[model samples]
Target: MPRRKKTFLCGHQGYGQICHRCDQTRTQREKADHARAEKKQKKQEWEAAFAQDPIDLRDLPDHVVVKARSIIAGLMTNTNYRDFGGKRLRHNRFIISIPVTRNYRMLCRDCGSFLVPEEVLSHEEYNVCKPGG
Candidate 1:
């Protein structure tokens, strides 16, 4: 004998005991909800991490933030600023500029023995902040 399609209360016809169409849609919606929740959790974690940083890196791009953190870690370990291709600002000898990326720079203050991270700025911002750009 052959099986027959039956209409479920959802008004969907299928061979199964439950309406496969509604079930599929429900499953997809659950999966999407799960994914959205996961993404939100990750975003929260990312935001929380900024509190631990010595400088405010919230406005920088992801890659620039990572690079700046690495440089900050290196500086904390007594690494030489020159090793990171950093140079003292011509106008302000106490201020050191480290290249976080081609378009971004991390400024630090020379605190006698170690460097204190100040801020991360884009090329345009850096230029504008200089005495003569």
Candidate 2:
């Protein structure tokens, strides 16, 4: 058999090669993969924690719903939405609105008007334009 060539940390007893370099590269790759997996897990956990539930108007208390109804009622009386503003009612408009993927508005079937739960609009006329009774 020929004399063995000088070899590095890899432990291969054949041709000239560095031994520990392969091990170091493998360890580095494993560390990178572990960090990536950790990042993905953290993102999934955050999404689960902050996920929103569907809105149901009926489930809300009477007091929470009253102002929204009144705002819609006021809009029917020829008042501009901007003028008939209530911060609290507008903030909670999601309660009355049917949840849609993209467009989130209370549609009135009677007059074919889109209504914002928080504001009054003379043109939208939610009272006259009754939707689903």
Candidate 3:
């Protein structure tokens, strides 16, 4: 079988004479620019017809930060010091409200036995996890 000969366009080894197609595409792109702006303006007009909810930063509750830390701590058990949001958390950085509550699913500091939340030894008692006080 004869090996097919390769062709070049506009001196381009990949698509030699196809440079005319590239020029045609460029011309079409410029022609579409005006329509693109019109479409953008129409989209803005449609969006302006609706009302968006505004974030009330001052309305944030005090428990939000602590609750967030607790949730993140739970995530840390599986994730390596990384929060559920993919943010790296420092060892000492977290909510300190959750006391050593006995958790039936939690393991002991020395032993791998599960204890209740109220019975689970917290950082203050077992010095195991230092996430919360």
Best by lDDT: 1
Which model, 1 or 3, shows the larger lDDT?
Answer: 1
Q: By TM-score, who's the top model here?
A: 1
Candidate 2 residues 3-121, lDDT tens each? 67666555654454455567678899999999999999986864553232122334333443444455455656744445543222233332233321122233322233533443222
Task: Show pairs that collide, candidate 2.
Answer: 8-19, 9-19, 9-20, 10-19, 81-120
So what's the TM-score on candidate 1?
0.82
**Candidate 2 stretches greater than 4 Å from native:** 1-18, 52-133
Model 1: lDDT to the true structure: 0.92
lDDT string for model 3 (23-80, tens) is 7878999889978999999878645532221211122233442343354346345433
Provide the global lDDT of candidate 3 against the true structure: 0.37
> Could you tell me the lDDT of residue 80 within candidate 1?
98
Cα lDDT of all candidates, in order? 0.92, 0.44, 0.37
